[model samples]
Target: MFRQLSERFGRPVAMAILTLLGMWLMVMVTLPQLQMIDYSFRPNLLPAQLGGPEDVWTLSNYVTLFNNEIHRAIFFKTLWSSVLVTLLTLVVSYPLAYYLAKVATPRQAALCILLLIIPFWINEILRTYSWFIILAFRGPLNEILLALGLIDRPIRFLSGDGGVMVGMVYAYILFMVFPLYNAIESLDDNQIRAARDLGAGNVRTHWRIVIPHAKPGIATGCIMTFMLAAGSYAVPALLGSPGSRWFTQIIYNWFFEGGNWNQGAAYAFLLLVLCIGFMSLVMKFFKVGLGDIAK
Candidate 1:
């Protein structure tokens, strides 16, 4: 349809029409998201008692964000944990993604890729709960450890960062794997063959050819995995120490438990902004926009 329109109406007109249509579509999607931004800064006071309607303007809500220690801690924890998770996922996923995309046979490649995707099909919450079955004191891991005489008692895997990172990596592995895999898969195998044929060894071929080609995918996978793992609530709630709460859990507390919607909105907005900024940084560094994956 676009090709026909370009021929009939001329390419520039067709481009203009498509651009306008794209903008309209974007506006439709983006307006509500922007409204969330507006709501984040909205005043918490009821304006009917003051002078006007409920949505009357005020900066009090946003100001509270800076004043709250609980809010500060949650934000920091989420940011720090996410950064660590991103680094870990990159280390774990890159080798696996590279091997699958570059070295595996057709059937082995499909099976390996399928193994990564299979867990994602399960509900995330259920997957997190499944970890409880493995890590709980009375769980199979504990039973096995005791039988092996590795410890006098069960280990507290689910009570700290160890459990949280494990669950996070489990849930987010696909995000890391798929992007890196797609990025590696798109490279021309002939380049690798030529490098090998020219007497470049395995290490040289990968270092000079494979890693450069897979850079975008690696960046994308890290960005996505970090974002999702950081913002996630249920896994942290289930796996993390109740005393050491996650940021998302804290946000939930503010919204529902604390009965402070304004503060909750502020927390959410801060998280969203941080994620966007990181994504922009990744795009700038990689010389590829987030949309490039789609392209």
Candidate 2:
């Protein structure tokens, strides 16, 4: 690997890049996680109380999460909602990605990709706020539905998880699409043609060849989409109703509003762990190995 990198970038440059990567891993990733884990176990102390007898490590922060009924419910709701969002993104993106990767001409695919990326030129917060406006009670969407006689009255889209889910799917759908596209794009077209010529229907061809070959992309897209949806703060904050507060909001409240860093860190750490466990279950169900997903 070092030799290849040196041949490509020269030895000094390759060594410098490797050194930077090592520093990034230690400083940006490992150290912050260690700090958060440390804080999660310690007491939430005032400046004066810190390092005193009452500042000793304890499990009370985590205990609070397990004991609080409302928080427990919110956490579970957020978890399942994120899963639902991931599934919805997969369904929406797979066909589009397949078309881009397999069916669309190069020019057509480039145009479509450009269109998809154009929306991202705007800031994400502004995009989410736009969705918030569109989903309002008398907003354009509800008004359109009413005009089309789909419903007699304006629907309160923001009253529950409806608005949040919509925003989440819209926000994170591209994360699923790009990964699937990358994976499918690398596949050999000959295999697909041969399958079709051998009396295979579209469904069978895809089930046996396309999907299995795209498993890595599916795994990568799902993991990234799920994690982004779960960790998202701005979309839910702007688009969700009070009744549909996300778990991240609770973490924010603990950290800023409640002034309890210990509890906040505990909640944040629990969220990370739960997401990993949930993704593990998903991987097992799909028979996808961690190595494949990582690669």
The best candidate by TM-score is 2
Candidate 2 Cα errors over 4 Å, as ranges: 1-19
Native-vs-model 1 lDDT?
0.83
Question: What residue pairs are clashing in model 2?
Answer: none
**Taking the candidates one at a time, how many backbone clashes does each contain?**
0, 0
What is the number of residue pairs that collide in model 2? 0
True-vs-predicted CA distance for residue 52, candidate 1, Å: 2.4
Clashes of 1: 0
- Local accuracy of candidate 2 as per-residue lDDT tens digits, 63-157: 99889999999999999999999999899999999999999999999999999989988888999999988999889999999999999999899
TM-score each candidate: 0.82, 0.92
Report the poorest 10 consecutive residues by lDDT, candidate 2.
Answer: 278-287
How close to the true structure is residue 206 of candidate 1, measured as C-alpha lDDT? 82
Worst lDDT run of 10 residues, candidate 1, spans 43-52
Candidate 1: residue 258 Cα off by (Å): 2.9
